[model samples]
Target: MSTFPDYYALLGVSKTATTDEIRQAYKKESLRTHPDRLTKATVEERKVATEKFQAVADAYYVLSDPSRRSEYDILYRTKAGNKSSDPGSSQNFFSQFANMFAGASTGAGTGAGPHGAMPGHQPDANGVFADVFEELLRPEVERVVPWWSYLGAACGAGLGFIIANIPGVMVGAYAGNRLGAIRDAKGKSVAVVFLSLGGSQKAAILRALALKVLGSAGM
Candidate 1:
């Protein structure tokens, strides 16, 4: 059996909570646990807060997405009464997601220095690029691509017919179909990773990337 987070508990919401309620709970929890709110705290305290914030963000991300939430609900129901006796079960689950974020954070903080020491806190280009790519492609990776694939083939054929003739149209359709199938397969692979994640971790990355994407668009 795959392990999963109790997102509802993480967000301090009941299973029956409405979307708005969940959003409210997330906002409250996020603010309360945000690392910035612990400026005076010791390093360990701040670390704990950061982890809590990530978990809250992860919970919100899953619970807010209707389809993902539905999948989670099914799994949650299946595991509902089967409480583990191990005290570390929840911590283990959170750590799986946290480790991903922690690595990203560490890389970003340390920057691209060979010794993990940079003069200023420069952004790690590779780490940032990887996170951005993962977050941006996540939705596409979750999308159903069959209809889009057919559409791509049709569009390709039409364009080819205009440019060349029947031969071009046939070539274009084949190329487009292959491209679509490639994308579909890529999405399936990413979807498998999503399931392996136990249904969390993209939201914090999305939030970070959204600022960059939206900032560029505005400028």
Candidate 2:
């Protein structure tokens, strides 16, 4: 039997928590644990974030549905009761929903990235990042003022996430001391490595940075 992750624990929620509470937890955790948000982190850190983000999504998906949540609650209770004697026992919950959670892990179930693509098949990192950004920000934007025009902002955010996290592209203090830099329109000093971008790409990066900053500030 597969090890069933503690869905409530993963979401930082309780069995008695309300739907809205679970959702709020999911959104907050998703923002924090999203792999793109950890671009500057080490590979090990990124891996942990990826797994955590996936688990958060999984927890939300199961608990949001009444029937699924009921099934999970039973298993969770069983595991808790049998924890001491059979420390290795866990429901086959993972196997039953492997495909569903797997899709979420790959950025597919959320429709943030390409759909209908096989698992582990990421043909274009740029497109993947772009889609992920759009999906991440869509819920918040729609909540205030739903508009298609926001797609432009999402595209820019996606590109920014990718460039900011690109492997070997260090920034902040480390890069500040070594790479030096050029200032963009926003007056933020961009690393020299990104000087290759054209005017349009540069603008997109800046726009993304601005949106990210505002979003984080709860604007």
Candidate 3:
């Protein structure tokens, strides 16, 4: 008998959920179940996390596509319809689809759910990389902070550099001590060294700081 997976329940979203809501839930769930997050876990734990991650990815791939989602809904309703009727029927629509899917995969199913395989023949070696790339490219509303916040930090760093460069102070001591202070408080220092020179050198420092902030935020 063919089995119809509950795509909505698997995604932890209601049947009536909006597209954006489904996408958000999928991102949150996938990140939580991602295998990379369980590096220190036991073997069994890693196995389970992989399965769960694939399931969430499968759910998102279907629900995010308008045509596939409509087709899935139809199958979902038909299965529901079957359950409410007599159980003596010789065959069901889903069972046929399931059989066809098995034949297509030639019994070596992708770990993704029955319907979740990408279109065409994807070489196994590249599947995981493709999935990660797609996830990163998907736009979402969540961000650690606005772009302007990083800009402000860069500005603050520049202003501090100017104030520390008063004519009487030795440039090396001022830059080294300021860097040490940053290191002591944060337990790490920015990799790029900033010089106290008041011209293009200062511009380079500010640019480095801005890039550092953006990198820290995973932009």
What is the TM-score of each predicted model, taking all chains together?
Answer: 0.39, 0.45, 0.43
The models' CA-based lDDT, in order, is: 0.52, 0.46, 0.45
Question: Against the true structure, whose TM-score is highest?
Answer: 2
Model 2's TM-score against the true structure? 0.45
lDDT of 3: 0.45
Model 1, span 1-219: residue lDDT tens = 535667787767888998778766665565555554343689989787766765665565556546446755766687876534232344555444333222232232122223121322222222322332444546643443355578778888987898889998998888887776666556444424433332124444334334554442111
What ordering of candidates by lDDT runs from best to worst? 1, 2, 3
Q: Against the hidden true structure, what lDDT does model 1 obtain?
A: 0.52
How many clashes (backbone atoms < 3 Å, residues ≥3 apart in a chain or on different chains) does model 2 have? 0
Clashing pairs in 3: none
List ranges where model 3 is wrong by over 4 Å: 81-117, 120-219
